[model samples]
Target: MVVKTLGKEDLWCGVVGGAALATGGGGAAMPREFFDARVDPLIEKGVKFQIVEPQDIPEDELIFVRLGVGGGIERRMQERCLRRFGVADWIREMDRVFPLPKWAEIPDEEWARVAPYRRLVELKGREPFGFMPFEIGPNVAFEIIRAAMLGKPLIDADNAGYRAVPEVSLGTLNVIHAPITPYVVATSYGDLMVFEKFLSWQRAEDLVRHIAITSGGGCSGMVSFDEDFIKKGTIYGTVSLAMKVGKAILDAREGGDDPVEAILETTGGYRLFEGKVGGTTREGYGAFTWGNIWIKGTGEYAGHTMRIWYKNENQISWIDEEPYVTCPDPFTVVDKKTGLGLSNFRPDHWPVGREVTVWGMKCADLWRTERGLRIYNPKHFGFDIKYVPIEEKVE
Candidate 1:
């Protein structure tokens, strides 16, 4: 078990595979262009990143999971606001209006002396948080950057495995009954609001979404505590898993192998359908994109149809109205040729008649257990069927 360091090359694949793992849910995939514009500068100026295996995490230290919250519809609206208000000036305004807690930079010995005191104040009565991701994405990059800043190790475990769900309650954190309070939400405009308690996952979800909407439709947040509490709850090696999937896709393209096959082979996924985008309709709620998409068959399966229902991530699939695949399992649509994931948020970009491949993979092992199913059963999403694994449902 050797530890691996992730650098420039891995970031590209990490982002690509992490987005695919998001399973058409999660926040919009952070564009490579955006990465170049926003993150490259930080790297150029000496920020570095490395991913440690979860087993390597020191039990004595605290860990935190960080992520972003928002919807595609609101994201679009926020972009318009940014353009009108001016990014630089607006960020400065946000800093003035929403100040974050600041701590002084000091030597390790001095910091160690006060760390327990600081942790005591932060924890109050809450249990320690885990040292992994809730889900991977551009936020993983943000976490890596934060880890670099704090001189802490970023472990490669992620609570959701690779499938991103729409709510905080949908994660391993909730399943394990970990306290998610004492979390911090930092707005794009620089406002930081901390929530020290929540009565329920639903309440926390609503509060986070409300903050995101009012604070310009997006925010970076973190749950911090000691590492011991989340060790069993998290599924390890997910970041490396994403990197492997991404690397396989790139390898396939350059080596003239089938990219889609490469993706399936690398990720142990099965192709559910090969078709064209047929039609789609969506509904926007508090901070989620819920919708159904139709993919009409082509080639060997001509004239057949597949329907997928999504709540951020793809939830259920129907073959001509027959229940096919459902949530707690991953359902993703990718470009047939390039093997790139198509955001459920932008089916319009996928367009009618464009070739796409639908892939299904088992959700994280944690998501398949009794408690996991309790949190993610089809009934939880208002579907009538008892939960079935994707492998069982797919022909």
Candidate 2:
């Protein structure tokens, strides 16, 4: 049951941020890189951060949400009828109703423009619930320090999307009117202070992006404070849970155990396909640079392969050329090295000539949810279809 940490040094630097980034509009970005940037410059001028998990976030504390994951908002959410998010029922049991809207989807051109800060950047808060992206190492640490001074709950999981996206407003936050004061915030830094306040999250995001463009790409604010919303809206335990999954794989590898064996012991996920990338297609349209992946079977599953597709940052859907998932029930993605998990990282360009397996992160209950239709299932993410009771087992 014991698992390993994300890296040699667990401390503040963890593996959840990237995955958070990958979650796009689904979850919040892991501010590890951003936090790193703030620790110095902002800390010198007074910035702070606190490490807390979903469970640790005080239910009564006023909070705000932020994004480490953000790229674009879907302009045609209503038109597309996309439902890849958690079931509203399950989500309601976990927390308040904060259904996010797909705002503006990222244009591939603009995406290329913001790619640097998009990955491994620190977002700090200064005002009541302010935030700024910090690329430099020192500023990241400074932001963490400032968050600590806020004396509010900084839950480990991002209540918002993953990655350093366009702006905070792009998320379903403002549209849902979930009362967004509990997330990231920014302050002082002079002109940076103007960024501290905005008429709406949309305005704030627009301002921030403009700042980034003006600054050559992306800009980081010294203050990132969003305590109120933390006390109110946002998903709680998902982030910590994601970190736990990654750590489990890392730990299993360190323990000299077959990571897949360890993962199977941990997640009841199904190994839907084991193959190599046989095909690739990139669809770049307006704000989207989408792609599709094809898996050619090998080993015991020879003659059966799978095909997966995705938008710029998410797994859009899957079509098993073999439909083998009927037996596995769900699909999955595991580390090629340990066969544990592909966490934060997923399959992109195949044909690299490597043995691989695709698993699904499915639970029986997930299949019955409103979003249980084709493409929205756990198999969509290439996760094996199985649910592990880690919450109960670990507890």
Candidate 3:
């Protein structure tokens, strides 16, 4: 019923708020110069950016999940390379070298025949398929831009709410049996690879991660699915949610209000802890930046301690050896003074003794289900504890 047109202000808000929703992952918030350079050019060419509420998306239409597949400085290098060479030119180069599958449209007849409700099985596509992103992030802009180029509309809902994850198969899309294959992976240097067959979500993720590593730091992927399948499975209303969060922060700075309170009030998030970064350690292997960070409480919470575990984004958080907030629910680290997000991608950027605030929010209802817990539970990430929602654990 309510649709939001994405203007310049909305775009800025979305990026900032979406970075918060990213929960310390989803790549760094796009630099203003990058957005103007990359997205503005498209706008000049008549590209329209609009966020459609899930209820408004026609059920029969397809939604493609678009995401970036790599990390580190190398990925940035790859992105710059990709931008230098246009998509058409990149595709041509990919075809010239790798010669993997190119994106193709799937017809209604083939899509309607998804083999009768099988839960966990390989997605055998009789034809080429596509889907749109169900998440928000730095990658989100690219998805929007690509969708505009391809002439399709993106759904307002995303599988992870605004949260970011390390692997492709971890989202509600995979849990809901949404097919991820017939997906295309494109790198900055113009190498392309396609995966049309995967028996399990892990295999799909593993394969994609491997490709990302080989293809330079990361690549872009497009996975198509029926919009109806993701309607109930995703976190709805994120477009408005992101805008509100972004605006809250901006308003705070302009009005001389406390940015931290602004964010907590807007998102219903809790300021779980405040501290200074003691140190951070992370390593890259298999498409994710995996690591842990130590923060020693400062000011009011002085003498307390906290540690967070992350795979691209913050996933497991512990305070004073007590299980704080783990996966499924989102937790993030924000600069204590500015309230801006800090990424795990580069720990050196955060440095030691930087003041930071940790916040936690409840994950989507979809992730609390028994099925959902099995996918993102703390134990799944090798922790011994069960995940308790941030709302339950905080107050």
Candidate 4:
């Protein structure tokens, strides 16, 4: 099996490229501080960050999908929980135990960050062969970090293709009707719940979202033993795609070329709009960041305006009151000058008067299928517009 070892530069590229494809959700790319504090130390200890293609894994190997439910509200909830739990107290107890005993012995503060996989091993009676991220974005680094910590390589695939979505039902695994149960959910504050069965994907989303709201935010691990299901249900090579896109941006900047143009060329995506952020509004409710970003056109788009509506990720965009682009085709808002994707995880990033560019890429072919559209299209998000392929809309 061929495995690609990642260096610091490769991981940075993954973070930036994943953020661009995140379509304004999936949490911010792993921050520099986080990398310096957590990942850097691991690398110093000779921990290798690695990834493997989906087809390279053995047929009988097990893969676990790790994901998180996050929104602006969840961040606030996290702060509240931290204050209530007392961070100093939690830190003091960190060294009180070593190799925590089984399930409940793990501290609440560390369980969500470290125990999901351990819990999975306990339930499965064997170790997972590799780890898979639920989607692209900072989730790339998240899975990489988890895999590195566990001395395993991450699968170079994601269930959400090149973009992140608000609902669990929107994943390609759901699109392919794969079994998603026997999963584990752990909150930041030490709550753990396991679902051995669920009636439907919608029900699972509901449960997870509610728990996220109540507990600030949390991580979830999904187990699958079937190789056929794993191969068919995920969009392969997305991690590599993110790295490519990121490298293009970096190379462009170093070579004094337009990073935005480099991004378009690398992904074959379209420049949907160029302007300055005119205004923005956002609300955190039902475990989602619901908002709109208005951009006042500039240059060739002068005198016009574009508005983007998002439910966690960019869902639909309108230009001068006409529907311009809509999901499940992924679109993102990026800083026009820097070419970095602006994150919806932080509302301040979209402040008024910031120069920006809006770009979009075609969704994976699976998302355009009748079933994929049913779950991801405008109607699913309560919009009346029909789904239009990004390519068609641009043309």
Which candidate's TM-score is highest?
4
Candidate 1 ranges with C-alpha deviation above 4 Å:
1-3, 29-34, 37-40, 72-131, 188-191
lDDT for each residue of candidate 4 in 66-119, tens digit (9 for 90 to 100): 755755465556554432455346434443652234554435545576566677
lDDT of each: 0.71, 0.37, 0.69, 0.81
Question: Whose lDDT is greatest here?
Answer: 4
TM-score of 3: 0.82
Worst 10 residues of 4 by lDDT: 98-107
Each prediction's Cα RMSD? 6.1, 14.0, 7.1, 4.2
Cα lDDT of model 3 by residue, 112-204, tens digit = 112211111233332222334556555555555555555455566787765777777678876777767676665544345567788877777
C-alpha lDDT of candidate 3 relative to the true structure: 0.69
Error of 1 at 318 (Å): 0.8
Q: All candidates' TM-scores?
A: 0.83, 0.49, 0.82, 0.91
Report the candidate with higher TM-score, 3 versus 4: 4
Query: What overall lDDT, based on C-alpha atoms, would model 4 receive against the true structure?
Result: 0.81
Better of 2 and 4 by TM-score: 4
Report the C-alpha displacement of residue 176, candidate 3, in angstroms.
Answer: 1.9
